[model samples]
Target: MTGNTNSIENAGDPPRRDQSEPRRVHITRGLVDVLLELAEENEPSEMNVVLDATPASSFDATFDLDPETPILTHFYLPSAGQSVRKVFGVDLGTPAGRGRARFLTHPQGPFKLTERDDFAAVVLLAVPPWDDDTLGAFDRSGRKLELVVVDAEPPVEEL
Candidate 1:
């Protein structure tokens, strides 16, 4: 019933980061603000967003990560559910599929990731509509991202 039980493809589950991997993620406060803003814009309906990430060391469109490398979230944009499900249906021939730092906001409650969510996303969320100060980021496996809010976004034009 298992071949590489941890593989995202094996169970169609999101790839998990074990204790050996870097658990901390640094994201810009600006990005969180954007999420809250999007939430307001999409309120009454769940909002989905695609965020751009760069490894503190190395990263790729494939989202394969080095055990020791950390990640940072900078730029993000509003996305549709189907677009994210298909990586925007863009030509994956280039780095256009480069972001794994995607998000979906549920105006519901606390953070809880589910099977229906796009495996590549790490829903960094804040609730109560106006509470941008409170935020949470989690992966599909229920492991939390030790989030650090930074002051600025990266200089990349797009992801």
Candidate 2:
């Protein structure tokens, strides 16, 4: 018991963590870098600018695309619902993808992320069954694009 306290050999008993788990989590820092890189290559605009967001519950937003930027989409948490999901957005003059937006925390949402918008962060989503999608640059004309997916098969109408 006279060895270094930080010794890996000791490997003190692990502490128990809270039972809470994230429903819809954001991309990790490592993945974020890769995402940005992909976004950069397609850079929807000539300006070197990064966008910041504070996503809200039951909310939707649009991002203006630049010519040289790239974008992607994806979905996780297989236990959610079985909806014919789809991602919608401007097609940057190239029909690489489409623009569709839906709530991530719906009773019929694509992922089992109900009651947990706090941990949700925006990232590229995948198409239905594929569970993820990605796009490069915004549509031409600088029009804002929205991300759309089906939370439920029939799509729960937002009140």
Candidate 3:
């Protein structure tokens, strides 16, 4: 892999782990609180966040997963005008089906690997109808990527 080669390879791919490996979103209670606070402020619409996914250390005796686990930890609020498309730098901000706008979807559809996926880990999507927030992970190439959800320790102090 060369300089740009790595970036190109990462596009449309997970940042830390192989697509074939299992995944679990390790977010902190504080992160969830912040997201909820943003949602409440914005009231319904959607707030999308892009974050770097890194491998988290595990110490559970019963914890059994390959070391290749990629933890999606993107948890933050977007600025006044920032958007996923703008951040990703693809398409012309085209909205998806059902008149809902601003969803992070691959313009060419999933599994279409590019340099972007290699670097970008995941986009935290917060939409209305937030009740059913859990969706089992899936590969962009269309395979069932199993997921595990755990409340992680806050990455930062709650000053």
Candidate 4:
């Protein structure tokens, strides 16, 4: 799949870090497509995709996809749960049995994700439902997907 390298921030002084300010993160279409493909290939009972600011800090959304549609969809931040469901539609949580995706925040300070960061990598952890759990179910298994945002290709201005 072709990836788009669009920098989320413009050339200027970086924004000051303030806990009071709300930060917006951008997930590329390419990254979403890759996750979709992975879900289609390996049908897991539950999937956890986390967008983490640091190893210990993050926010996440989880979905229970056992039913024809998701039986339950939750978010670490209650405020974002509904909007995320609406935005992604049912496609995101359908393939995996009961998917759980999360966006993590910093452990100590406020959310530290900034445009200056090289790229944000999403870590996916897949597990089977308790009913299907086996001896090795406790084993930790997952994939780390990286998204690199470049500034070389900017959008053309309309005439």
Candidate 5:
């Protein structure tokens, strides 16, 4: 006398994963434009922006740009277990007699004068996972942009 135990549980339901877990998120140029619009509206002194490596991956990160120090900070790469380089330079073309000069560049730092009306913007380039063959096959750079507004006030502490 065997009882039937072969019935499937929630067969029609989609698989569920923990929402709190750090998952990969795709950040497209269009999404960046939407974020820019949102940032323009609020103009928060400081804000925290997070980016996921993919949709179902365990790579998550955050970036911050401080206007007070006028420096970019709090860049985390969990997968790498460290923070990335803060400053970078680019060639801006040389003068008639001047040699090739490098312009101070902080791609993930404060926004340029032209990019904002009242708020400064920070641009970050996120490289995709090197181990991801599928992603690497299409795009070697795997660059994504993340923007955060620096906050004016400090966080309150609980005593």
Candidate 6:
């Protein structure tokens, strides 16, 4: 079974996982809050985040199927005086169908929620209806949102 490590194999073909099998990537309470907050602000026309679970956690989760379905997860936030933080799981749908967006950050020091910059907040909104009028809302907002548009497709890996 020896082969070139870097050669272009049918690596694109990802083996499927049994639906009955339980998944390991459980969405934490924090993740749910982030997703919900973003969704409320965006109000996407369709789906939200897309999670592609695969047997190979590293590089075998991109295989496509008929209209991908999204897995929903919820979170709770306690510090902000809120009872819970709600965030959706993942969207396995197609580009033409549902959309996806995400905000991710890291906990530092003692995992205190008070620290504003303790987490690197990133929001990736996948809008299937990517139109000027739709996207313009964010672009023409009076509030300042720090965003950097990367020209190249950023590397896809679960952190």
Q: Which candidate leads in TM-score?
A: 1
What does the lDDT read for residue 132 in candidate 3?
A: 24
Task: List runs of model 1 lying over 4 Å from the truth.
Answer: 1-22, 55-76, 79-95, 130-133, 156-159
1-159: candidate 4 lDDT, tens digit per residue: 235334444335575577444332223333434444443444532233433121111213222222122111122222335566788664443334322334322222222333322222222222222111110101112223222221121122256
Higher-scoring candidate on TM-score, 3 or 6: 3
**Candidate 1 least-lDDT 10 residues:** 56-65
Each model's lDDT comes to 0.60, 0.29, 0.41, 0.29, 0.27, 0.29
The local lDDT score (0 to 100) that residue 49 gets in candidate 3 is 44
lDDT of 5 at 141: 25
Cα RMSD, model 1 = 8.4
Tell me the tens digit of each residue's lDDT in model 1 across 44-157: 677656666655444333333463444555544443344555866653322466667666666776566666666564656655554545566777576777777666544455
Q: Estimate, for each residue in 113-149, the C-alpha lDDT of model 3 and write its tens digit.
A: 3345322233333334332252223344434444355
Q: Mind sharing the TM-score for model 2?
A: 0.17
Q: Write down the TM-score for model 1.
A: 0.59
lDDT (Cα, tens digit) per residue for candidate 6, span 41-140: 5553232233222122222334232223222232222123222323343322323332222332221221112223212122222232332112210111
Clashes of 1: 0
The per-residue C-alpha lDDT of model 5 at residue 136 equals 9
Instruction: Name every residue pair that clashes in candidate 1.
Output: none
* lDDT tens per residue, model 5, 1-159: 246334365455676676444322233333344334433443433222322222112112232312222222122221231222222332222223321111112123332322332221223321212112101001112222222232222222247
